[model samples]
Structures are given as structure tokens and as C-alpha cells.
Target: MSALTETDPTGAGFSPEGLARIAPWMDRLVDEGRLAGLSVTVARRGRVAFARACGQADLARATPFTLDTVTRIYSMTKPLTSVAVMQLYEQGLFQLDDPVSRVLPEFAEMRVAVGGNRAKLETEPARRAITVRDLLTHTAGLTYGFMEATLVDAQYREHGVDYLAREGTLAEMTARVAKLPLLAQPGSAWNYSVATDVLGQFVAALSGRPFADYLREAVIGPLGMIDTDFFVRPELMPRFCATYAYDRARQLRLFDDSVETAFAKPPAIASGGGGLVSTAADYQRFCRMILNRGTLDGTRLLGRKTVELMLSNHLPGDLAAMGTPRFAETSYTGIGFGLGFSVMLDPARAQILGTPGEVAWGGLASTAFWIDPAEDLSVVLMTQLVPSSALPIRRELRVLTYAALAD
Candidate 1:
């Protein structure tokens, strides 16, 4: 089948034949019924090198997937929240090292879970308060309820500490999280958690407005990410894609139908952790700002120095040194956590075809995007599938895309 792709890839150091290599691979997945549909965009030096969408967006409806189709971005929301909060930082609102409790009093005195399970929890006072830096780098002692790995997280599940839940505001949920015991002492380990949700509240507390409002005005609006938001509008429902998950037999099954999805309406909580829906085109604009070093067409969102700090590795070493290496957005070996994105310390160690200093992150629904400063590149993959680990698409695309680079 033919694909809707770029007419020319030469302007951005991409081999036209090399880009041709991507279509058949992408088509094979859809042909094999591995993915319902997917949209990919590869840009270099502020120009589109390659773009394509293959297969059905709504398999049941036989809807054709297009580049503008919107899908849930999930955890990918972290980077935007990080950038928004950092804008406040550039304005001298708060320092990276400042205690988050300085603005939100809920996190003033926190506890760490030292022993026991959800049934019989044990704890000790946090060695220190969770800091803005900790939240940004995920060094904060916070834990996600769904981890199912530790007593702290178990308690999180027991307490119904869910960010996706349609009830309660960000402020109410932040208070709920603060009341729970931390998985580790602040800055002790790297466990992916609801720290970004807390950062959302931190944004509201500092800005004296709602999290959604601040994000829209400061980050999403300024970057011209018009289709990126907490929920899809009624008029845009036709462009929303359905989400999927594998059944016990490893067959594709509808996870969330496109027509009747929570994303169709504005959410109550406005999760900063995993709650935005965006199109491949919209998200690329956001990536373009990062590649442009915190400015897009004279709409400067952050200072150049602040952008530098966001991309730098905040952890002392690689994520593997962070301990035990729990399930995270990226691999542990040579990957490092920057302010928001995962920094590639050494592509060889991570065993991926990526450049050193490249920053990237993915959503829970198998959607991913990476910005490479060294190569002046950004790639976005849009798809709807739960448990992003269900398939090796992210790494596979990494190999395929990097192999297509002419320079």
C-alpha cells in the first residue's frame, strides 16, 4: 500500500532510499496485525525529513490513521510540566534545590517506608524534604501506586492514589500523595512516581492559578502545541484514535474506544504525570522548541542557560547506579535522568543507536519522542497501546530511524 510521506528528505541529511526502508517495516507491523495504526515524524534542523502513517486508527471503524490523529501522550506529559515549572524558575520563582514545601505546605514533613506491606506499613521520617530538583529528576521519594513492588507503593494502591482517576483536583491529589509514606528517603533512589503530578500542584501553588491554565498559557500555547491538552475537544473527537491492549491470547483488543473515551471531555484532575492527548504534528512543534534551545519563532519560553540545565544529567552517574533499577521510561545502564527527559550518557552502554546527550521519553500508550541536540534531530512515534512494553517498537524504531540517517 502507498503511504503519505515526505516528498523529499535530502534537505535534512536523510537518504530518500533509507527513509523508504521505514515504510515497509511500518507496513509489515500493520499487515501482521501487530499495531492497529501508527504515525511517525522525523525532523532534522527544523525541517521534516520523513513522515508517514499506516494502518487503521480505529480498526473496528476502519478509520485511516493520519499524521494529525490525536492519541494519549501519558507520561510524556512530564517534560512539558518540567519546562513550565522551569519557566517559573527562570523568572526566579523557585530554585531547583528549593524544597517543594516552600510553596505547597502539604509536603513539608514527609515519611519514608522502611518496612512492612500495605497491610502493616512501617515508616521513618524523611531525611530531608523533597526538593524541586528531586521532583524534576524523579529523585523525590514518591512512588506510583501501580508499581506493585514496595510497601510504600502498595499503600499507594491501597489508598487509591491514582492520577488518572476522574475525581479530585490536582491540589486534592497532591495532598493525598503527601500523606502517604515514601518508597525511599529523598534523593536516595530513582523510582518513577507521581512526582510530576506534585510538580503540577507546585506550579499552581507558585503561579496562584490552576495547573491546566498555567500549562496552556506558559508551555503549550507559547510553543504552539495547539492540539496538546488534558483532553480532546468535542469538535476534535473525529481525529482521536482508539487505544488498545493485548488479550491473554496475545491478540489485539480494544482498550479504549475512540468514540467514547475519557479524553473526549476535560478531566477533573488535569494530571501532569500522564494526562495529555496530542497529535504527531503538534508534539513536533514542542520538540522543535527544545531543538531550538527554548525558543520557537521569537516566542521564548525559557532562557538558553535554563534549557542547558534541563538537558544535563542531574544524577551523579547512570540510572543503573540509582539502585535495583525498577521499571522506568528508559533503560538503566547508561541512561541518566535530566530535569525531565532521559539523557543518553552512552549509547553503547544503553545498547541503542542513539547519540550521547540525546534526551527522550515515551508515554504509557507506546507513543514516544526523542530530541537529539548533537544530531539536530527529533523523532515522534504516535500509537495507542497500553503497557508500552507490550512490544519492542520503541527500540525497533530507534534502530530503524538511526539507520536511515544519511550523515
Candidate 2:
């Protein structure tokens, strides 16, 4: 029941007592059987402020984890990809509305899925070619590895579309993806998907560099996010936490050892949407950059205007196109879908109680983080818990964490 505290890196007013509020919940996740290992960090005004780790790196012993322990950040990579694309945006690499075909040309004539037998499927020109903005906003009418039940899914499988493998290049991924039909027309509906992966290819095509190299130089390098990358170096392997999934019996258990060398080096397919590993401390560097409005410390990754554009919700009404809003019970009712994360505008409508303008996103592995510029607060809760089972934990953690700010 003891409180954990750390000094704020900026010597700001952010106090350890703020983090003390969530100490019990973090402990209970281990004590009550919801998680095997986890790390939580809350920083305000450029400082660590609070950090804690509990349970064993593995299930065997309750040995504490370290800041270096890497966790699969799954979709958290979206924000990074968003930043990369936005970096190009700031440089005038491509206007947001430019047709995606302008860069890759592969998706210029893509088809849309109309359901039913593959043999009798209808084919037509995409209402509009996918745009650069579409890729950033998840409205590119694309699908993910887990979506679809027909030829498209089989194509994904046959193409060996492993987002984590260190073999296929971004161009190769685009060619494979282009062959598959889109589930919707560009900018017509929202579907959380492989759009960012396409953006990765976009980065390669426009920058004339590999997606991983572009991200490293354009995003990670400038932000000093050293621990965030496609692969965890061999020396850092011990800190790479084992990923867990719902077992056949519906229990949490370790799955694979970092998805087949993904954490070792840049995979051939750079999944801008979902394929990256990072540590809590490392990811803070990225979040802190966003919270700072495109600048952190002194280095600036985006213009303030561009940051505003990135954080603002881009989805139109008729939310039917996008997949069901995830984690509504977390009080996200007034929240609307943005290009990369969820945007909270009317806390009342979203039935969520956070400050307005609070934006957030989570990875499939239950990793979640958000920045509330209004409150000058940032929260990151990391765990290997399955996405579904961890919902209660995330809601409780957010409510409890925000409640402490009431002080």
C-alpha cells in the first residue's frame, strides 16, 4: 500500500502524489490476477514525475520489471506513423488531399467489396483514389489482417502479409494490399485498418527512403525516442516482455517471443498502423512531443497548426462506417474518431467525463495512453493484458487517475 514517486524531469509542479492515487490499482492487477506484469508512468511538463512496475517479467516469480522492459505497442504505432506522415505534411511532401495514387499509383484503380460470392463479385473504379489524408485518417476504405472473410483475406494470407516479418518492403506491401479490394470507398467511411501501413509505403515512395529509415530519421531521431523501433536490439531482448493472449480456455498466457524477429530489425513490411515495440519511458518521449504541440524541449517535429490538424477529429457523421467505437463504457461517448486517435469534445454526449479536448488511443495488447492538453496531464498505462479483458482495468485506471487531479 506504499506510494511510489519519481522526480519530474522538468522540475515542474507535477508531484509524485498524483501517481500515488493509482498505486493500489496497479498493485491489485497483480494481486487480483488481471495481469502478470506491467508498468505505469505519468509525466507532466517534460518529466517522469511518476513510474512504477509490479509482478514478474515472466509469470514465474514476482520480480519487478524495469523501465527498459519493452512491450508490444501494437496500434500505438499509429500515432508515430501519423507523425511521420505529418512531418512530410509540414515539409510539403504531399498535400493531405492529394490522391494516394499520385505517390504509389498502385491504388489508383482499386476495387470496393460489395459482399457475396467472389465469382460473381462486381468491380468498379474507386469513387475517388485513396488520398494521403485517407491513409492518415483510417478512412482509406482499407481492411486489416484480421478483417474480411473472403478472397481478400485469403490474398492477405497467400501474400505472406506478416506485418512483423523483416522481409517484405513497403512497396511490396503496397503491391500486395493494392491487389486486395477495399471494404469501402476512399473517404466514404471509416474503418480502423492498414491505412497507415499504406502510409508507410507512401513515406518510402515520396521520401525515396525505406519506411523504417524514414520513420527513424523523421520521427524517432528528432524526438530522441531511442527505445522505440521496429525491433528490439539483442542486448535489449531481456527487457522485451513476453506478449500474452486469451488462451483457448480464455485465460491470459504468453504467446510468441516478439513476433518472429520483428523486434530485432526493421521488418520488410513497415506497419505504420500496428507494428512497433517500445518501453513506457521511451514512448513518453513520443507522447510528450504530441502534448507539447509538435515541439518537445527545443526540437520541433511539427508546426503548431499541423498538430492541431492531427489531433482534431476528421470523421464525418454516420459513424456507421468506422467499426463500433471501442471502450464506450470508459466514458468516451462524446468522443469522436480522429485520423489516428479518439477525440473527446462533449464529455456529456460521449458519456465520458474527461476534460474536453482530451485525445487518446490504445494498442491491441491493452497498452493505452492519452494527453489532456487542457489539464496539462499525460497518462500511460502499460500491460500485456488481452485487449478485451483489460477494458475494465483501463476504465478504472483512467477514472482513478483523472480523479487524483481533482486535488
Candidate 3:
């Protein structure tokens, strides 16, 4: 395990004193029992300036967390899945505006719920076929079963839309989803749903290989993200971190043990939406690729213009207004959804300390990463906590990180 230490040289554009505040803040969180274990890393101009680890990876076993601790990065997998799809796009296999039905015909006859209760549902024809861009921007009408506030969301749970059956596959799961009514019309509004999972199926169909295989061969292999994958290998199990949730008394308690984790083996469906385990160092390589304009150590996964299009705002006027639901972890006032990330449009409107054009995303377990091209900066925060909305740690980390910039 790598100890918390400053790795920057004299000219790295980060104040050592300012960078020093980061570990202490994390220590405070662990001291307060808000987090079981955590690790953080910051880099600028392609060089690491700060790296640290704190708390116990397994409080019950007294295992110390380290920089190489593997964690379930959940939705952070979306960005990587998006990159894979775009790689096929670069091959001229399909256009962004192309209808998803063109590739996955199962979605051809999809319907929208007009106005109905969970007991009785009404339906209407979709305005148009859902496009690849709609899935990328989350304008598609798909809904996650876990988001159970709405009637459609409730229907998803009732129908077992998210069940990762031992014998089921992405193609079969998508086919099941097609039989359900959509939560909204295509391109009508922004809803965080199973759109990315659907994109995974589309990728498999277009690339002539399984989604995970293509992801490993095309993205993870080239980036040298040795520890990032859909499942943790047996040899690396000792370094995997356990997950936690706050008890009724708001105390940290064991939720999932690393030894018996679901990620111990691969699932039937490769959930490109929220199914990945990664390390701080491994994810940093992915972020650095984005920060370096689609290239890392001479390995180019995407073209410069393609990356620019991805980082730019894709939402229309006030479409981001639809993103501020009760469960949203981000401030929607000045943020917009891009191809595969959240783009900061105006930091002032967001009421947070950040630069415009910055792109970022977080996992369900409090893990997060951001790339600021303007500042040539990248930061990765790793931890294991269920119901990520439990704290504003991501915002807190942002303030601490930007405050330490020497330039």
C-alpha cells in the first residue's frame, strides 16, 4: 500500500501547503465516522502533485485503505462505455443522430406512457425513434427500477427490469425493456435512466463482440488500466474495499464485505450504466487521457474534435431544468449534460467553486473524478458509501482542490 505523500517536484503549479490540507480534511471525515476509508489523488500538467490514503478499508478486519484499493466505481463506468460507443462512431459505423432502432430493432415499437397510474396505464405512440444521441444525452425515455417515485419507474421495478439473471444477457435484458412503456417521449426531457445500459447492447451489436470484451481490448487495455474491470480477479481480492451504509443512528455499518462482494464474479449482464470496479490510479489514467485531449502516453483513443464535442453542452434551452430531481447529486442551475459527462456552464450559477467547461461524474459509493482542461487539472476521490446522496463530499473536495492551485 502506497502511503500518503507529496510526489510533485518544485514546478508542478500546486502549493505544498495548500495540497497538505486535503489529507487532513479526509482524516477529519474518517475521524467523524462519516467514511470508513478513502483515497485521493490530484494531478496537473500531466504530473501527480498529491496522493494520500486514510481510514480502514475493512473496519471489522482493520484493513488499511491504500492508493491501490479497488472500489466499485458504479456510474463512472458510463463515461468509459460512452467512449467505446464513440470509437465505433469514429469508424463510421453509425452517426450520433442515427436511430437506435436501426441497430437494435427491439426498440422499434417502443411506446410512451401518456397519463396513468401504476394500476392502469395509458399509452401513445412515440414522437420518433430514439437516437444514439438521445441515449448519450439521457433524453431517451428509459428509467431505472431503483428510481421508484414515478409510475413508469414503479413499473420498472414491478417487471424486474434491472434483474441481472444468471442466464440472461444484455440482448435479452434490452428485449425485456422494449416491452415496457417509456417514461417520456424521446428527446423530450432529461431523465437519468438505463440509457447507458441500452447503449452497451448497441455497442455489442455494432462491434461484433461482447461489450466487456470490446471495453477491455479497446479502452482499458490501451489506457493500461490494469485494475479496472467489470469484476475483481481472485488474485486482487485482498486489496478490494468493503462497502458501508449509515445505520439508523447515522453510524457507519457494514453493508457489503469485499470477500463476499457481488463483484467477486462477473454478472450475466454487463451494466455499462453502473457496473465497474476500479482503483484511484487506474481511473486517473482514464482522466488524464481526457485532460490530454484524447491521448495518453501516445495512445489516442479518440480524436481531438470528437472529445471537444463530448465536453461541450448538448442540452437545449432549460433542458437541464429537468435534471434537478430529488435524487440528483449535482447543482442543475449552471450545469448541463454533455455526451457522457456533466458540463459546468457557469460556476456562479451553480453556487460552487469551479471553472466553466469542466466535465465530471461520480459513482454511487461516493467515488468521483473531474477533468478541467482550462486548468490542466484532474482529481480522483475514492470511497465506499451507499446512497451517495448521504453527503456533499464531492462539492467539498472540489472547493479544497481548486483552492490549492498555485497558478
lDDT-based ranking: 1, 3, 2
Query: How do all models score by TM-score?
Result: 0.97, 0.89, 0.97
Candidate 1 weakest ten by summed lDDT: 1-10
Tens digits of lDDT, candidate 3, 179-248: 8999889988888888999999999999999998999999999998999888899989999999999999
Q: Global CA lDDT of candidate 2, please?
A: 0.72
Name the runs in model 1 displaced over 4 angstroms.
1-7
Put down candidate 2 lDDT per residue, 139-257, tens digits, no spaces.
88776656544555555666666566667566777788888887777888766677888888888888888888899898988887777788777877767776666666756676655
- The models' CA-based lDDT, in order, is 0.88, 0.72, 0.88
| Per-residue lDDT of candidate 1, residues 1-407 (tens digit) | 01224646888888888888888988998998889999889888777888889988899999888998989999999999999899899889888898889998888999888887556788899989889999998889888888787777777887788989898778888899999988888998888989999999999989998999999999998877878899998888888999999999888999999998888788889899999998898888888888888888888998888888899999999989986766646899999989999999999999999999999999999999999999999999999888888888889889988988887
Q: What is the TM-score of candidate 1?
A: 0.97
What residue runs in model 3 are displaced by over 4 Å at the alpha carbon?
A: 1-5, 163-167
**Taking the candidates one at a time, how many backbone clashes does each contain?**
0, 11, 0
Clashing residue pairs in candidate 1 are none
User: For model 3, what is the C-alpha lDDT against the true structure?
Assistant: 0.88
